[model samples]
Target chain A: MTSQPEQGGGQAESLTRLTEQLSRLPGIGPRSAQRLAYHVIRAPKEETRELAEALLGVIETVRFCSICQNVTQTDPCPRCALPVEDQSIICVVEEPLDVVAIERSGAFKGRYHVLHGLLSPMDGVTPENLRIRELIERLRDDTVKEVIIATNPSMEGEVTAMYVQGLIAPLGVRVTRLARGLPSGSDLEFADAVTVARALEGRQEF
Target chain B: MSAIRVTKLSLTHFRNYAAQDFQPADGVTVLAGDNGQGKTNLLESLFILATGHSHRADTDREVIGWSAAREPIPYSRIAADVTAGDGRERVLELVMQLAPRGQAGEPTAVAERTIGPSGLRGGTLQKGYKVNGVRQRSASSVGDLAVVLAGPEEVDLFAGPPADRRRAIDSTALQTDAEYARELRRYERLVTQRNAALRDARERGSTQRTEDMRLWEQELIRAGALLLGHRITMIDVLQKEMLAAHTEFTGRTGHLALEYRSTVDIAGNGGASPDLQQSLADALEGAWGRDSATATTSVGPHRDDLRVVSGDVDLGVYGSRGQQRTAALALVIAQSAYIGQQLGDEPVILLDDPLSELDADRRERVLRHCLTPGRQVLITTADVELIPAEVRSHAAMYTVKNGRIEAA
Candidate 1:
């Protein structure tokens, strides 16, 4: 006979709900989600409380910066607050994490604009979903010179970058894209043919 | 020894084969059985293992045994233990499981092969490739067991549509250069993406082109140039290879030629030269007008053809049946030699009833040629006596009946 086990114990219902919610997260499958739920149930009460607090902490404090549209706790993200040598150059990216990637390189001391997503018609993603209007509004100033499209070299990423370029090009700002080639420290012999071809095409002056 | 000979092949829920394990000979093996006895099914499982798709099955699920529904889970598995070029042995496996329709997944050449137009009826077909227990894309494992298949149907290469000829060369390219497979998949996706972009623009009633169009065009050309360049270089090499084999096959070789005719001007450029890329770029740019009107790409390697010309006669148009058949056989032989020369691994030659139409003398010639020292040849036939005694003397013979295979 099929009986509701959760009827006798509310904890079973809570465990089921927790597994479902965890499974919805990226990279967490049903089995992993169930394992994670069980792990949470087994861990000490204080550790589980810390994880819950951390989750709430991010949602409560995280906000998009009004200027660059990157997730931040402040109205203007730290990157936007900083003064750079070039007000004209702004690197456009698909996500806030990309901003972190660029900052880690310690190069390109300029402004940044996060699009939040790429243009993917197949997945129903479109230009309207991204923060393109904010990017264009930032480019309205005559001081802005170049908008380098730093989206990933993927199909949807290219479409988003090109769409943004179309909007900014009319504002008289120069448009550019990140160079794609083989990664640094990779041996040429071991490099794939496609990567080698890209490196050859993007060869820089020695 | 053949570069990579399959020492053992195990199949389950595949075609008429409910469960079967085959051990091919090191030199030449013959499978003799009546029609509908699952002779070709064994070879087909090996073909799918080598190339990731059935040579004849329009859909991948067609390979699943009809009685497969009786099983708890309807699936087909083909696994092989191959002796690689260096005499090192490894396991390669492919599994096709039934999955619910409407599962959107990564676009792979193998997946594309499985799903046809009517395939959307939701027949569950999720195919995968595994190498040495670690899963990988079929493209990565294709050349692991390089095989050159010569069958009766293949004799129609010249008479068949240009698509068939293009596919023959593409198959060879896909096996020889793994990058070609990646580029091929990218090019296919680019074409679809480009067409979708064009359709979106048309729906929006836009007359002015956008930077996205230029971007797609640029990427398309870059990928297309590589495909065209590789095909041209390969066709040139195959022309000479096929010629030598043709000469040896029929003692007639002067007029046999594999001319790669392309929309791009490849007259001067050899291989994937800068000149060749420039030629493709110019061609695509020029065809953009026609493409915009058609909402599809009109020029590229997709439209190119590999023409087999016998002197002044175009074999596809006007070749005798015998000439076409011999040439097709030569093409397969040349392909095997080419794969061996390029990858330093002699490909296992699969001849599916190839000697059915040939005379005694020619069959002897083909048998002598295919069963040469160190080469692995697997040929199937209904008439066992057609095989010369000297040939059968050393061959590992097998008999198939009602989907069951047994050593002869």
Candidate 2:
């Protein structure tokens, strides 16, 4: 029953290799990786081919936008290439995902500049590691009147925003943060004290 | 006054308790048990539900039962069903699980391990909080089930370090005022980050360190001023109540006073006045040289202390044991009253063998004060007689043995 080890070893090795590769992705554990590998093994040949092609296509074509550091297929992301209707305001974000989130809101018509990461000294993420140089260079044109820091509300994010604010303040551009709102449908009683206090502070006359 | 009570409490894998359920009475609920029979554990579970932290144990792992620790996926949970002053019922739950450590720089062996269906592979711990079955931050869960715990540790309020006194006052303030809690949390984060930045600046000796330190100082002053303002106001209210409580309990003719000794001179500008922020900023700026040398943010509310005095003598330094205990008790009682006055709700009081350190007369006074009408009181004692007869007659008593509780 245990004979034919040489015959079975090739396929087992491939499955093991796929599982190991999948496990290297963030949030994918070994068990999840194994399950995904087995699913892929059972998936249609065309589907697997398509998945592999998509992964390779992304690696080959996608690049950071030269203007805003956002991951994009074009040199200047679509947002940067837009007409100069709101050339006076540029919203700064920590990552391309943040740009997507803001775009989903549809409330902001201004352009965006993605920093790609926050300033985390403990993590050795210094200001030099981020896209701050490009941000300051964009401000040197004197056309941007407002720089909105839309970084996530975290310690490192706040530090990065403040650091960028301090850098651009001398350039005569007003800096603002995205208003923190009470999450919709959340009970005022259940919201954290900070969020509740901020919501009250920023309340509008309904 | 609105009455806040814990209607039901359930514990699983918590200290000394494999599984236990308790339905506390509206009035006095007595937990009578021998030593190590989970009496304190029962009280601690309720306290944890209210405060999102344990009074005795520093880490959640310490609160997990030994037998539970032997399980494949070791975890401890404390849940309570509480009725707010408005009669709205809510469930607060805290689950602490042992997991592999995920902090950076840790050895790869101690890093995130595959949490299989079987069990966790590492021994580090993490805690999760839930309110009404919905996940929430620990701080946000506070005040949902307001509680005032007076264990034997209360006696150390006056005698213990200033940090303890600050914590006692901060805990009460956080429960009463949401604004104060927000400011306090922000101030704590500012202090930690500022300290880290200070250490980094000192190590690098960069020219930008001065400007960076100045920016942090400005933020610190803003946050620290708010914290100082809240603490000062709270101490003022607590001082009056504490004095009254001490007078009622001791009947001795000495003035009890509570003073907030802030690192910054709040009195000069009348306590967090418009000018106080500037004053604090200036003070922090002046301290930058020393802070840089020390590699720590040294001047802020973090270094402040609460001073308890009687007849101009500092209680922490000069008071006798009995005097210290009475002062501590007075502070606890005053805190309950303060909460009632501020929040319009009387917090549920949990007393764990507090009568042990007091004389019979003092014990009777404490029992009367705690068993105030409409306020829920849960007391744990080994001897039933330790509780005054008047309160005992009205109390719903239970006996705890071998980590089990039943009606007595």
Q: Report per-prediction Cα RMSD to one decimal.
A: 7.8, 6.2
Per-residue alpha-carbon lDDT of model 2 for A41-131, expressed as tens digits? 8999999999999999999999988888899899887767878567889999998888889989988888889898876545555667789
lDDT of each: 0.77, 0.78
Worst 10 residues of 2 chain B by lDDT: B103-112
Can you list the residue pairs that collide in candidate 2? none
Interface RMSD of structure candidate 2 (Å):
9.1
For candidate 1, what's the TM-score of chain A, rounded to 2 decimals?
Answer: 0.88
B308 Cα displacement, candidate 1 (Å): 0.8
TM-score of chain A of each: 0.88, 0.85
B1-408 per-residue lDDT for model 2 (tens digits): 888988888989887788888899998999998998998888877766665566663544577666464554567888889888888888888887765343322223222243333333445666787878777655335557777888877787778877777778877877877667667877777777677677777678752565445655667788888877777778888999999899888976568889888777777754445566875786777787787788776777888898888888998899998889888888888888888888788899889898887899988887887877888999999899888788888999999999888999
Provide chain B TM-scores across all predictions: 0.90, 0.89
Best by TM-score: 2
Off by over 4 Å in 2: A1-64, A72-89, A105-110, A120-126, A142-145, A154-159, A174-176, A182-197, A203-206, B60-77, B84-138, B141-144, B207-210, B269-274
Q: List the residue pairs that clash in candidate 1.
A: A88-A145, B3-B346
